[model samples]
Each structure stands twice: as C-alpha cells, then as structure tokens.
Target: MNDTTTFKQSLTINLRVIGALLMREIITRYGRHNLGFLWLFLEPMMFTLGVTAIWSYTHANHLGSTLPIAAFTLTGYSTILLWRNMPTRCVSAVIPNLGLMYHRNVVLLDIFVSRIVLEVTAVTASFSTLGILFFSSGLMKAPEDIVPVLIGWMMLAWFGASMSLFVGALGARSEVIEKIWHPISYLTFPLSGAAFMLEWLPAPARAVLIWMPTVNCCEIIRQGFFGPMVHAHYDMSYVAIFNTCLMLLGLAQVRLVAERIAPQ
Candidate 1:
C-alpha cells in the first residue's frame, strides 16, 4: 500500500480506538441507572450551587468585589473543576485500567485522552448549564465578550489535559505523586484565581501570581464574563507557551510509560 493509504488506515484505527475508549469510559463511570451520565455535570453543578448559596447567604465579600455572587461563584468554581478534576481522575489511573493494555490498539495515551475528554466535557456542561439557569432566573448577567471566554477555556482545557497526562504517567512510576497531588490541589485552589479576581491581589502578589497558567486562564475567562464590571489580568502568550511546553513534556512522559508497560 502507498504511504497515503497506510496513513489513512492508521488514522482510522486510532480514531476508532479513541471512540471506543470514550464510550467505555462513559459507561464505566456513569453506568446506565438514574441520571447516569447526567450526574457527571450535575455533581459539579450542585457543588457550585451550594458554594454560591453559602456565599450569597453569608454576604461573603469576595475580595470586596461587586460582581454578581452567583455568576462569580459559577465561573470560578467551574473553572476550578475544569483544571482540578482532570488531574484528579488521571492520577493512579493506569493501574486500574491495566487490563485494557492487553489490546493491541489500546495505548496509555488513549486512556489519558479518554479521561481528560470526559472531565472537560462534564465540567464545560456544568458551567454552561448553570450559567444559562442563572441568567434566565435573573441571578446573573450574560458574559459581555465570548471570544476571550472561549480562548481562555480552551487554554485551561489544554493545561488540564497536559497536566493530567504528565501526572498520570508519573503516577505509574511512583506512588508519591498520588499522595502529594491531593493536598497540592486543595492548596492551589484558592490561589488559582477562582476565589478572587487577579485585580484584587496586591500589586506585588499580582505580579508574581500572573505566572501561573491557571490564574491567567481565570483572568481571561472573567474578562469575557464580567467585562467592565471587573478588571481581568492575563497573558495569553504566556499561557500558550506554558501549556505547549507542558504538553510536550506530558506526551514524552506518556511515551516513556507506554514503552515500559508494553515495549515496542
């Protein structure tokens, strides 16, 4: 067969493999019972809702900002779930699915990709659903500019996927990753720009915190969301560069883990 034909066949096989894995992941995670996959987004939505309620009830001044509490909480918590859940699901993931490694086409990358896609889809859905419900019920206003929101969300997804791959691969090598990641995730949440706007930070803190990709992502998303009502700080170029490098590292690590698991 010619190179073109061979490439096409390989591409087709890989796509089929990914599709199968995605379906399997959904079924395995959500099951076929009540709400099944619906729970995927609903779980996060409910969590966000509870937090929003608490914030609203307590009159918690989020960094002394005047943004709508519900909208602010939704955007922030959803963003957290987007970046946080992927890595949480990925760490120590390979061992549980080692049985699938027996399949010729099933590779470590496929597993990671499946989990990442599942998480990104669930969180995005939750974010959108809550945003619409809030807007309709007069709890929050619609985003002023969607362009930055899309760009920012895509960037955050990229970051989450890459980090999950890297963490998942490393977890295969050592148990330490799984242990340390839990606390690290919790500690980082507050600083992730989800709880407060970057503009709320002191000038010194803002200067330093902007380097975090998640923070930049939050800034971009909120800029799209609250517009003039809030001042969002971000650097897309930095976010792009950081995510790209992390992706490269993640892919490289996954390759190494794959080779070790099933040598080519």
Candidate 2:
C-alpha cells in the first residue's frame, strides 16, 4: 500500500478504537441505572444550577444592581464545570483501565481521549440547555454573539483535553502525581476566572490573570454572552497558542506513557 493509503487505514482503525472506548467509558462511568447516560448532562446541570441559585440568593443584596447575577453565575460556573472536571476525571483514567490495554486496539491515548470527549460533551450539553432554559424563562438574556461564545467554549475544551492527557499520563507514571493534582486543582480554582469578571479585578491583577488560558477563554465567553452590558478582556491568539503548545506537550507525554505500559 502507498503511504497515503497506509495512513488512511491507520486513521480509520484508530477512530474505530476511539469510538468503542467512548461507549465503554460511558457505560462504565454512568452504568445502566437510573437516568443512565442522561446523568452525564444532568449531573453537571444540577451542580451548575445549584451554585447559581446559592450565588443569586446570598449575593443578590450585594450584586443586584451591578450585574445580572443569574447570567453571570451560569456562564462562569458552567465554564468551570466544563474545564475543571476534565483533568479530574482523566487524571487516573489509564490506571483503572490498564487491564483493557491487553486488547491490541485499546491504547493509552484512546482511553484519555474517550474520557475527555465524554466530559466535554456532557458539559457542553449542560451549558447549552441551561442557557436556553434561562433565556426562555426570562431569567437571563440570550447571548449577544454565539460565534465567539462557541469558539471560547472549544478553546476551553482544547485546554481541558490537553491538560487531561498530560495529567493522566503523569498519573500513570507516578502515584504521587495523582495525589498532588487534587489539591493543586482546588488551589487553581479561584484563579480560573469562574468567580469574577475581568472588569471587576484591578488592572494589574487582570493583566496577570488574562495570561491563564482558562481565564482568557472565560473572558471571551462572557464578552459574547454579555456584550455591551459587561466589559470582557481576552486575547484569543494567546489562548490558541497556549492550547496548541500544551496539547503538543501532552501528546509527547502520552507517547512516553504508552512506551512504559507493558500490557500484561
């Protein structure tokens, strides 16, 4: 076979492998129980909605006139739910599924990709459903520009997927990494731009925070959602370049993990 044909066959095989792994992951994680896979969307939806409700109630007296607390909470928390849960879910993905690696078609990268895909899909659905329901119920306005919102969402997903791969690979190589990441993630939460807007922060703080890829993506999403009502600062070029470089690094780490995995 020619080089092109060989590459096509390999790509096709890998895609099939990934598809199978996705199904397996869904089944394994959600199970055939109450709500089944619907929980994928429902779980995150419930979490985001709960947080929004608490924020709306407690902060309403303080934040009522300044911003739309409901919309702000929805957008910010949804971004957090989407991006933050990925690495958590994927950090030890390979360790639990090491036995599956005995199958020739199942590889470490497939396991990592499947988990990331599942997470991104679940959070995206939850975010969209919440947006639509809130808008229709008059609780929040519809997004002013959906194009940038979607681009921002995808960028966050890219960042999440890259981080997941890197963390998952590292976890496979060392037990210490798994323990370390949990606290590290919790510490990073406040800095993730989930609780405040760029405009709310001081100029120097904003300048420093915008360099975080998650913060940049969140700013873009809020800009698209709030439009003139809110001022959001972001540099898409920075987010894109950072995500690309991180993903490349993640792929390299995944390759290293694959080399170390000796299927029993």
Candidate 3:
C-alpha cells in the first residue's frame, strides 16, 4: 500500500480507539444526563460569575474604568480557565491511561493528543457560544482590536499543549514530582496574570510577568478583547521560543518513557 493508504488506515484505526476513549471520558465526567454538554458551559460560567462577584465587591470600579464588565470578565476568565485546565487534564493523560500503551497501535502521544482535543472541543464551544450570546444581547461589546485576542487564544492553546505534555511526562515518571506540582500550580496564579489586566501591574512586576509566556498569553488576550485602554506588556518572541523548547523536551521525554511504560 502507498503511504497515503497506510496513513488512512492508521487514522481510521486511531479514530475508533480515540472515539471510544473520548466517549468514556465524557460520560464519566458528565453522566448520561440531558444537560451533559450544557454542563461544560455552565461550569465555566458559574466559575466566572463567582469570581466576578468577588471582584466586583473588592473593586467595584473595575470595568467602569474601561470596557464592558461582563465581556471583559467572561473572556479573561475563560481564557485563563482554558490554559489552567490543560496541565491538570494532561497530568492524568499519561498516568491513568498507561494501560493503553500495550497495544502496538496505541501510543502515549495518542493519549496526550486526545486530552488536548477534549479540552479544545469543550472550551472552544463554550467560549464561542457564550461569547456570541454576550455580544449579541448587548451584554458585551466587540473589541476595538480583534487580532490580539485571536493571537492570545492561539498562544495559550499552544503553551498549554506544550507545557502540559512536558509536565505530564514528568508527572508520570515520578509521583514525588507530581506532589510538588500542586504547590507550584498554586504559586503560578499570582504570577499567572489571569484575573487582572496587564496594564494594572506596576512597572517591575509587569516586566517579570510579561516575559512569562502564559502571562504574555493573558496579556494578548486582554488587549484583543478590551481595546487600547487594556494592555499586556508581554514579549511574544520570548513565548514562541519558550514553547518550542517545551514541545521538543516534552515529546522527547514521552518517547523515552513510552517504551519503558508500555503495558504488557
């Protein structure tokens, strides 16, 4: 058979395996309820609203200073939530599914890619549907600049995929390392540049977080959604380089581990 035929057969086989796994994951999380998919949207919306309530209480004048409140908070919160979910989802990707490695056709990369697909499917739909509703209903306004928001989401997705794959490999190799990850994840938040706009950060602090790739992603997202008044002082070139390194390292580590962890 030609390479095309081989790839087609491979994809067809891979799709069956992946499809079954995806369905199991969805059912496991959402159950057989009518609102299964709806739950995904509700989950993020609820989290955003909870955070917004606190934000409004503490900083009553947040969006009043610039953009529309609902839109600003929804987009920002959803973007952060999307990036944050990836690592956690991936940590489970390689470990819990370790048994799948037994089959010659099933690879570790398959699991990682599957998790990424799941996150993307849920988040893209959730964000897009809610975003449109908010925009059309006059609950939120369009950004003065669209490019930044699109760039921001793409960057976040790439960074999330890269880091999660890397971190997932490390976590799979060592439980002790996984233990340490929780504290680090908690610490990353203050520096995450998630809840607040980058323009709000003071000079030196801004200098630091802006250089951090994920933070830069957040900055790009806010600039896209919020207009000229909103800004994130990130270095895009730095993030691109950082993600490249992480992707290579992650893929290498996975290859090394897959052989060792292959199920009987």
TM, every model: 0.96, 0.95, 0.88
User: Which segments of model 2 are wrong by more than 4 Å?
Assistant: 59-65
* Worst ten in a row by lDDT for model 3: 59-68
Instruction: Judge candidate 2 against the unseen true structure and give its global Cα lDDT, from 0 to 1.
Output: 0.87
Better of 1 and 3 by lDDT: 1
Q: After superposition, how far is residue 8 of candidate 1 from its true place, in Å?
A: 2.5
lDDT of each: 0.90, 0.87, 0.76
Pick by lDDT: 1 or 2, better one: 1
Clashes of 3: 0
Screening candidate 3 with a backbone cut-off below 3 angstroms (N, C-alpha, C), the clashing residue pairs are none
List the lowest-lDDT window of 10 residues for candidate 1.
255-264
Per-residue CA lDDT of candidate 3, range 116-200, in tens? 7788677767777777877887877777688887887888888888878888888788877667767787778767776666677
Top candidate by TM-score? 1
What is the overall TM-score of model 1 with all chains considered together? 0.96
| Per-residue lDDT over 1-264 for candidate 1, one digit per residue giving the tens place of the 0 to 100 score | 999999999989988988898888888889999888788888999999999999999998876788899988987899999999999999988888888998888888989988898899999999999999999999998899999999999999999999999999999888899999999999998789889887887999999999999999989899998889888888999999999999999999999998887532
* Candidate 2 lDDT over residue span 1-264, tens digit each: 899999999999999998998898888888999888999999999998998788777875422337677788887888888877888888888778888899887788888888888899999999989989988988898889998899999999999998998888889899898899999998998999887777888899988998899898888888898888777888999888998999999999999989988865
